[model samples]
Target: MSEKQQRLVLSIIEFLNQSIADGTVKQDDREGLEVAVQCIGEAFGVDPNDESQVGRLSIKPASLSSLFDLFMKTRERMSGSTPSTSTPSPAASSSKVDKEAAEKEKEKGNKFVSAKKYNEAIEAYGRAIALNPSNAVYYSNRAAAHSFNNDHPSAIIDAQKALEVDSKFVKAYNRLGCVFDRIQVESLSNLSWRI
Candidate 1:
């Protein structure tokens, strides 16, 4: 990692440590924190569990202070505690892409779908949605997986959610129409059987 990148990872670790010490992070938040730590570890090419690697980062105190300041400012902006007047930095733009860890979960869902493991695919897609609710593709993929599982209601809901996220998501509309048609056919079949 470059010096700046190293400092950013270190700053995140420091923030985690401080939050833990202050008991600001609840037990429910631990899983999210763990994911953040794992991402940081991956970015820095270091094992978060290994204290020795942290020492090896050779982060100076001055750098840590500056990083912490930036971290706090970013946090405030994210929390809407401060208005974001300035344009985002390049690092910030890259970080936004990095935050889409949901992409990994979505890929897993796709693998499950390809294997015809509809239930597993739904579960993986659900996790992906939980991680990034605004991702229209995740919802659209999940909707298809739900249809494969013979879960028309869930498929409809997911497709609708995808449309809600991105109105121009044509695939979601197509999926939704398919699910509705299936439901209609099932209803007609049931009516004939009742006759």
Candidate 2:
């Protein structure tokens, strides 16, 4: 991993560690936070299991600021605070039409889906949505990816958003149905096992 990327990972880990130490994070949530840190470490080619190595990792000031922003956003999300979307970001507010760029991202997402990289596909579809939020296809594509990732809630949200954007979006309905069906099957299986 590049130095900057390494720094970013470390900074996120540090934030999580601080949250836990300060009792801001509940005991039940600590495991998930630890797993998230491990995933970040793995993504950046670091072994989070090695406490010595994790301690040696250095974080730059710029990376710290970015990490702080990310932490704040995450805190807000955890608190169920809705982000203001009345004003779009600079990239989204630009006058230039980037339909081609959005299409390119969609294609990239498709390629990732074909490769069975659902997480990467979700990211690509997110970029497509950012570039062109009006496209219902992007949301539907992301919904499919989220389903593949076993993130049923996110899949449902994306599918619903797609339908809101275009009520006639057949794929969104299909994906939403599939996700609900899977959840039902899983629930039934669990109940049967308990019985």
Candidate 3:
């Protein structure tokens, strides 16, 4: 949380803290998000008790996402030939995507998953990823759909992609576990047959 890292990291901390406090985060994910927010809060200089200040920093979660969107576009502009290591691939960078639209596609994917339409869920998640290649959640959710469809290889790939985009994402790890669990079961069944 150095001032040098203030603008971007601070926005992330604010969004994550709000996501946890509002109870909008999934139950399984709350603990991890809380730990991250707590760690960042410790390094943050803002005093929760200070009331003398006439104003305080506040950023909407959507705004935080938009900040990333803006940065990606700016980075694309500054380096026209090749994307930096932190930037998305050239194919993904060429398109201007709306963050909120990507979120909507994710929601649609979730609905499709809940309905047991794994194919539809995968498609929706694919659209989300195409719109926002930087979002780990989209890849993680697509991994879920792929696993549900019994496409273990695709699930593994998507889960790995999710981790690549956001290393701290717990859901991507869970998605990988889902794929591995199936593989383990198959291996054990084969062993039993040989015995």
For model 3 the TM-score comes to: 0.49
What tens digits encode model 1's per-residue C-alpha lDDT throughout 1-195? 675576467667776766766788998887788778778778787664665555444343324554344445445544556435433221223235544677888999999999999999999988877767777888899999988887876786687667556656789878866775665455445446445
Name the best candidate (by TM-score): 2
**RMSD to native for every prediction?**
21.6, 14.9, 19.2
Off by over 4 Å in 1: 1-100, 188-195
Encode model 3's per-residue lDDT on 59-88: one tens digit a residue.
321246654643463345445433344444
* Steric overlap count per candidate: 0, 0, 0
Candidate 2, residue 102: CA error in Å?
A: 0.7
* Model 3 alpha-carbon drift over 4 Å, by segment: 1-97, 189-195
**Which should have the higher lDDT, number 2 or number 3?**
2
Model 2, range 8-100, lDDT digits (tens) per residue?
A: 577677777778888999999999988887787777887645655544454322235543544454345445554453122233342346778
Ordered from best to worst TM-score, the candidate numbers read 2, 3, 1
